[model samples]
Target: MGCCTQKCQQISTFTIAAILLGVGISMAILWNNIFINIRNKQLSVAHDTQGFKMWKETPIPMYMEFYLFNWTNANEFMNNKWPTKPNFQECGPYTYSEHHIREQLTFNENDTITYKTRKIWKFLPEKSKGKLDDKITTINTILASVADTVKDKNIIVQEGINFFIKEKSEPFILTRTAEEFLFKGYDDPFIELAHKLHIKGLDIPFDKFGWFYDRNNSVDYDGVLNMYSGVEDINKLGRMHSWNYKSQLDYYPGECGRVRGTSGELWYPPLDNEVLEVFSPDICGTVKIRKNGTILHYGIKGNKYVAAPEIFDYTEPQNQCYLPKGVHLDNGVRSVQKCKFNAPAYVSFPHFYSADPSYYAGITGMKPDPAEHHFYLALEPITGLPLKVHAALQVNILLQNVKGIDVLKNVKSTYFPMLWFKQTAELTEELSSLGKLLLIMPSAGTYTAYGMIAFGALLLTIGFYLMFKKGWKTIHDEEQLLNQQQTFN
Candidate 1:
């Protein structure tokens, strides 16, 4: 009887051990599956006719609002002597009706996707703060005697014929061939003025003026232009089926100048002078990311390195922008003249975050408050998605010496701030939910696995302890004590 009982007890112990081993393995496998699935979701790319399509999950289609910098001191710029100080005031934060459609469309088996993007300008009428009569008067004065009949129409132009008007009317498109979309310059007013002069049989000699002569005369294309993202990764342009399962987070370099990096992930270590370089098609150059730790407390949040308001006061670098390299006539000017597109004027960040002291120093009526005008982007590290984005760029005309352009002759060599714009995007609840789910899953699984392992070990330990202490002796007692047997069992 003792021998039979010993064998049975051994069987029970082995059975329990086997069960625990299986359970531990199962939970570990389950945890792995959960983690992989979530990672795959972040790297998902739907194959479509357009090619491989990928974008931020939140906000459905990404939203972009542009705040244009209207030149408040236009009269002073045009009329004042050469090298006069130019004053630009922050104007309309015009909300674009269009949403971005990014597609890495494949044409062949090699997975070459022609990344074609298009933006439709909404026909919404823009609101202006004060009258820009000063700007209109300046423009009319410059084109004196050439188009006499059109001078009246140009002076009385209701809409300010400036960067704001150009953005409103221009079609935003990007293609591989174009690489970057080049502005057609402020040609709308000139076209209207020219047409009016033609009606009066006055053939205005536009060729005589250097500004009009060298200006882009080609009809502004409303369709998308063929452009390149300038990425070293050939896979970025397109990828094969083998690349499908791989990470598709970085489709293209961000449009917000170059400092955004090829990853388009702005999250960085919280350290001073931590510089990050990113590609920007607009600036036609690579830009460096300037770190100001005041944006947010940096760390992992929701399975990603995100700068949230709960972690900090506000989103990373709110309402702020950074200065670009002064490639144009110096003083931190970003000139497109040196670019392949040969753009006329210069471009830079508004308020000049890292600009040369001369850019704002001794300049009258210029308010460059770093706190207000700087650009910042709050990025989620793991997913490489920007929860909150702000990109600010200023367009300036490099006025020095041009023979035929009479207006530019009197103007001194200055990186005049023509206009600047801020592009912004913020996080929504839907995205936060997604992020939180991803953040919670691994922790929950880990804790659950640990608990199960501990419980299983405890059960095994207690069983062994009793088996070693009471062993066959307890069975022997129970068999002898028949009444006790029922209680023991």
Candidate 2:
């Protein structure tokens, strides 16, 4: 009875060890999966802060390099200086500016967060080229010339008054002593005329023209930049709405003028070759996906341009996102006719990446090169935050023939390129650490989990092998001794 009990005890011990081994291996794998999912959820939750969701309150600094087109020799086209119209040519680097964009988030009573941004623009005079100091004088002189020509033609005083913005019947120069101030409308004739035209039921194109100075002269901290971001469904990501121009005369859907979601959603883990469209409430259309690969940026090969959330809109205006009004809306050329920016000029991407081929086909002095002038952005896919964003845009003045102004009648109605800018924003060290945690740490954890599973399996196999050795060797030795005893007898 003792022997039989011993044998049954050994068998039970082996069975228990086998069950434990299976459970340990199974539990290790199950626990690994559970922990990995927990980590992902934790990562997602980390972005959810007190007021802002998926956004941090860190201050980001943006650097901008302005490249002004040298129109000094534009009239030389008539003189046959070279060939073709000299409206846009020889765009060279001009000046540099820095903007300290401060963003604040406030949670409203209705489960919504109000996002406010204040831009403190500082012009670096040391880095400026050409005639930065003389810009005010130049604009005033141009207005005066237009006014003089209009008067000579005996145009209506109403139109003449609107044509030439005058503080007191004389051209005014916009000047600012400080670099940063509250956002205000510029004292520009174009903007004033646009407003007047709108009241008269004429949808003429113009933006909020103003000098880069606050209306009060003294900085107004309460003057926060007002921009609204939609958040109807918290289940999905929310995108910023198009910025409304304070001086917008009338809404023109044909112009495709909204600017907030121009480059698509800030978040991306886009599918391959996905066509991403800009978000414009006016024009229902999509911007062509110029480049869909991640090779545009080094160290980031997973990011690609994809369709924005607005593409799913079912209505007419919400369905399409056209590029702009004047330029070919089929492509992605920017049209300032409806943008209503603070300037009396048009702004668009350099070389017009997705613009119509004809924009540069006939122009001799201008050629659009995507390799040299393409906008580049690198975003971390996991967090949907921009790792590095670089945008290059060209600013041009529309030179069209007015009916009464003799000086403008002979000129071609074209967007004359004035200047272009390359704005860049990079992630700081603090933000970069967050990205590393989101991207690197998860991968490391996965590898570690796999290693643990492999180790557990190895340990189980060793345990079973040792048990077999002990039991089989002992039985074999006893059988050998019994056979020896029988032979001896």
Candidate 3:
């Protein structure tokens, strides 16, 4: 009975060891192949998922810092007694806290959601370098836009508009407070007169003139957007289906007209070393950015993408569509005239960074530095979440001699630097910790599986050793008993 019990004990030990070994291998396989994929799926922008909650209303703290170019020699230039080049003095980083919210979400059956974006901006006086009431002298946008509009009209009509401009004594250069040049907006007699006269080209939507006038806390400014919800297809998350209920825009032709790319708010996961496209409503088009390198944010690795050098390169075949007809723009500047209500407005990198040198040839005081003016985005590749963003854009206006307009007849044609702004956001400490946890959980699970496997192997080895030793002892005892019997015989 003792022998049978020992044998049964050894068998039971081997059985347990084998079971543990098999279980450890199986668990490792499941954890790596099945469970990991499921966990990633849960992170998709599906309804009721954590990603969806975050996308519905952004929790990241965002800021917009405006830097206006104070033209130092506007008077000399307007009087045609200026030097060879125009001089500009960089002014202010008027900072504002930006808040974004997606309103009126309508989830469709086709795995898409239609929504409108409402952005609210609050001025941060403490963060700003200059007060809003600080005086600034720049080009009179009203006079410039009016001259550009009627430049092609009948000669009589041109003279008639010119007569009105001269009679009103509209200054080619106007002085206003910084607030009037940005969000607060200043009233112009030309704006009222154009509206009263029902001028075709000068009929603007707003009564006041400002760079971002009537845009604060406005939902209608950024038109309706229809994007994928990522429920059925995770790769399509945040990908735009239509903007303002249209798949294409009339502002540009060919591929430039397509309403594609993400809304710069979210991106699809599992990003490889590829170009990323962001749809910017402010520019009324898509911007292509490529991976520059890698960056570490809060101890987590991220891919950094910057605007491609060919973004505004007219020589490139893809960007040829962005060039306006009959407009000979240099490689650096992109005309947003059609999108900006025919105002001859253009956009470039801050201080024309990465732009063609010709853009700043006729101007002085433009210092383009990669650290301050470049636009870049850092994203965590696994979750496709933005880790850091620096979106910088400069607004410029083209001035040229317009026929019959006395103020512009002798004006040297140049791209006038107006203002540039940098919209920035970064992952906060609390959010970074949460992101770190998400990244750590998978590795922790993998390590736990490895530990289980190792422990199971150790148990199997110990069980085999004990069984072998017990068998050897039993055999030795039998041999010794046989020897004793032989000696007694």
Best by lDDT: 3
Global lDDT of each candidate: 0.41, 0.43, 0.85
Candidate 2, which ten residues in sequence have the lowest lDDT sum? 173-182
Task: Extract clashing residue pairs from model 3.
Answer: none
lDDT of candidate 2 over 236-326, digit per residue (tens) = 2333333332312243353333333332323433334244434433222223333345632334334644322232222336424333334
Q: Which ten residues in a row have the lowest lDDT in candidate 1?
A: 172-181
lDDT of 1 by residue, 1-489 (tens): 433566677667657766775676577678877784545444433343111233311233343333333444554543445434555455444444434554434334432233334333331335323222212111221232222223234433323323323544421110111001112123334445545545442343332222212223222211212222212222232112222222221221233222223323222222232344444544444455554443332233321221111211112242112222332223445445433122245555565545666666634445665644565655444444445566566665443433333343454444445445555555566756665566567778877777767767777776677777765444666677897777789
Question: 171, model 3: CA deviation in Å?
Answer: 2.6
RMSD per candidate (Å) reads 12.2, 8.7, 4.9
Q: Each candidate's TM vs. the true structure? A: 0.58, 0.61, 0.90
Q: What is the lDDT of residue 363 in candidate 1?
A: 45
Quote the lDDT for 280 in model 1. 50
| Residue 148 alpha-carbon offset, candidate 3, angstroms | 1.2
Model 1 gets an lDDT of: 0.41
Ranking of all candidate structures by their lDDT, best first: 3, 2, 1
